[model samples]
Target: MNIAYLPIDERPCNTDYVRRIADSSAEVKLFLPPQEALGYKKLPADKEMIWKWITDVASEVEAIILSIDMLIYGGLLPSRIHYLRNTEATLWIERLRSLRKEHPGLLIYASNLIMRTPKYSSSDEEPDYYEEWGEHIFLRAYLQNKKQREHLKKDEELQLQNLIDTIPKKYIDDYEERRAFNSTINTSMLKLVKEGTLTFLAIPQDDSSEYGYTSIDQAKVMKGIEALRLHQHVQMYPGADEVGATLLARVYTQLKGKRPRIYPIWSSTLGPQLIPMYEDRPYQESLKAHIFAAGCQLAETATEADIILAYNTPGRVMQESWDQSDKDITYTSFRHLLTFVDQIKQFLNQGKQVIVADCAYANGGDKELITLLDEERLLDRLLSYKGWNTNCNSLGTTLCQGVLGLQGNKQKIIENIIYHIIDDYIYQAEVRMKMVEDFLPLHNLTYFNLKDKVALVNKERNKRVRDAYQLLIRHSFETITRLDVQTFAPWNRMFECGLILKCEQSEVSKKC
Candidate 1:
């Protein structure tokens, strides 16, 4: 089936991830807009060009994956900064209405983000005032929301009120006003979904904490969805970036009429409850939501499961290489790491289809686990492996690929295997860590803005990443037919990459 996708921004997580997973499916043929027209952290997307492309392709594709933020506000960053009047802002709904009129039966899957107030001061994605006052505002919101949830004593109430008052009323007002505006837009989109315009709608909480604006907005959104009383047509979850891929998986499941059963195995039993940064709930809740979003079922036992998802999570708190550099590596004596690999080996030996979600850390893959897999010749033997960006991002990608692999699509399986090797093992495990130490400090400068330094970084990223692929290709030249690539860090840092490509081959290629 032909699918047209509109990403939230040009970030690799947003742009390349969903398209890659969708195209890897034998049942899907995906089309996307030109990368030049999309927005970055500070820049806005070419709205006119994107809107035209959407209209041109809406009729040709079997389904359309739309990011309402991209359509209404050039991009996610632009959504935060754009100054649009009421009528002008609602024009996107009007645009969608027109599309519905044009194609009476087009399947539309759309997503909206519940606005996130960052904890730290970073002007990279927020307004200029955020650099200094961002933390202060976030604190005020936290205390204020907390006060409402729990009964604060006289002293605590006054302290919270005093803190809120210390914030410049204008700064606080501006922040509140933006949230109000987005809340309005989100409510309008809810109405559209209720009126039969959207086939499926996902409103993901972007970034979250226990007490914050996310909590406040979620309460209000839950009420709105309840009022509309729509079941199986809409949802609100704890991830923004993973929603696109999750929705595409939903579409593919609908097309194929299959709901695969998956059994999840974690390195640490607490891994499922461990909530990483930027998310509100535990990892377990998010896992269930992604599975439900994809129209799949979760199995209670591996024996009854169609697929096995072995998730490598950190024991206590997930840490990145930069933070855990002083920590010792895991050896076979480490029960968590050792037992995890052992279970995976047993599952493989049992003839079970296994997909590894290597999220032992947040930003990159777990080196200890990768080393074990390589030593065991299991690196390229699994159905798939993903260890990039956030845990949910890795989880959803591997989840979809695993479920779809049940269809016995040899082509999709081969392409997915290549992606797993290149992304999870080669880049996340090896090149990424090396490059950071070698190039993290650029031009004798620390904390440099990427706008001035992206070209240099991307140029080097392309060489190192592409060369890794080429090296692997040469090793398995007979099995590999061809390869294509455009790798870069859209966020201007090396936390993740926007790797968009396609590899056509009959046999699965895997080697260390």
Candidate 2:
């Protein structure tokens, strides 16, 4: 299959991840735009150049998976900060229409984010005024929506009115006007899906909450989807950054005309019902939505499954990845790690392909889960292992890798396993916080801005990752003579990093 993927941004998770998984299969030929053309943070990509590139390859590729934010608004951050008028934005819809007209047979899978309203005051990814009034803006909308939906106490009413009166009207006006514009654009995309300009559409909610601007907008979009009766053609879920890979998986499955059955096994008895952070729905509900979105089915029995998704979720309580060192007692008392690993071993013994979704903590992998897998020498044996950013991000990418791994070469699949361990586990869960705590202070650096000291920070990062690899993985996998892992701070921040892995490999007939 020939696929052209336009990522959400130049992030490694979006670009390199899809490429590595696609490379696992010789049958899949994937094409991506030049990284320089994709632009930097808050900078719009060269849309004309990207459009030309896509048109040039449209005739040859079987499918084109696109990030509508990138194609129209330049990138995800640009989408949030863009000054494009509604009329100007609508022109991009026409561009999509033209693309469809030019290539009627091309399958178009696209994703657009419903702009997020962070609960905290941080202008790092939002507007400058957000540094002062971001929380106020989120609360204004949240309180107003809550008041309308349910009764509010007198104190709550006073707080809402106080926020309305205290915040600068201009700031609120600007933020809301842009949201209205983005919402219109979302409706326009749905219209495209209905008209057959797009084959599949995913509207992923980023940093979504139970109630607020995001959920309210979701209700509006849900009404739009129902009005158009496009449920079968559209999927709305809690995810960002991972939607591209999810759609790519869908395209791969549709091209092969196979809906692989997946059987899910959870770490805790109550894990499936508990909602992870930054999302509104329960973990298992989101899992079902993702499975259906990926062109895969939920297996009723392990005997009939093609993939065993060993999902590692939270116990009675959930916390950030960095807090795993002092994790809640419920993690041990409520969830049994021994039973989880034992089930994974049983599945492997039964000759089933297994994929691990290490979602016990948000923003990194679960150390306890990774340690158990590593001790059992099952790290490189799984089809995929992902725990990064948000719960949905990990779930979506893991599913994509699992689907592609079915036809992947053993070497490529093993390489992906090592890649995730280094990035998701070694870097995100452990080293990132260590640098912020230990290394950053030595250079007078903050987590948000590494400044000119990025190289110094990354130098320390690479060393720590290499050491962790030696400690956690090298002993079990002796086939890897030397593993040189380099980490890059793409946004010059500690929240995420890009990894370049170099491995010296020897031939092995069996799984490590």
Off by over 4 Å in 1: 152-162, 327-335, 408-442, 445-448, 451-455, 458-487, 491-495, 499-512
Deviating ranges (above 4 Å) for candidate 2: 509-512
Tens digit of per-residue lDDT, candidate 2, span 1-512: 99999999998889988899899988899999988899988888999999998899899899999999899889999888888897777788898999999999999999988999999999998889999999999998889989888978999999999999999999988888888888988888999999999999999999998888998899989999999999999999999989988998999999999999999999999999999999989999999999999999999999999999999988889999888899999999989989999999889988899999999999999877887887897777789988988999999999999999997887788788889888988888888898889889989999999999999988888889988877776334546756678889889999889998876677753223
Q: Which prediction has the highest lDDT against the true structure?
A: 2
lDDT of each: 0.75, 0.90
Shift of residue 223 alpha carbon in model 2, Å: 0.6
Candidate 1 CA-lDDT value = 0.75
Model 2's alpha-carbon lDDT is 0.90
Cα lDDT for residue 69, model 1?
A: 84
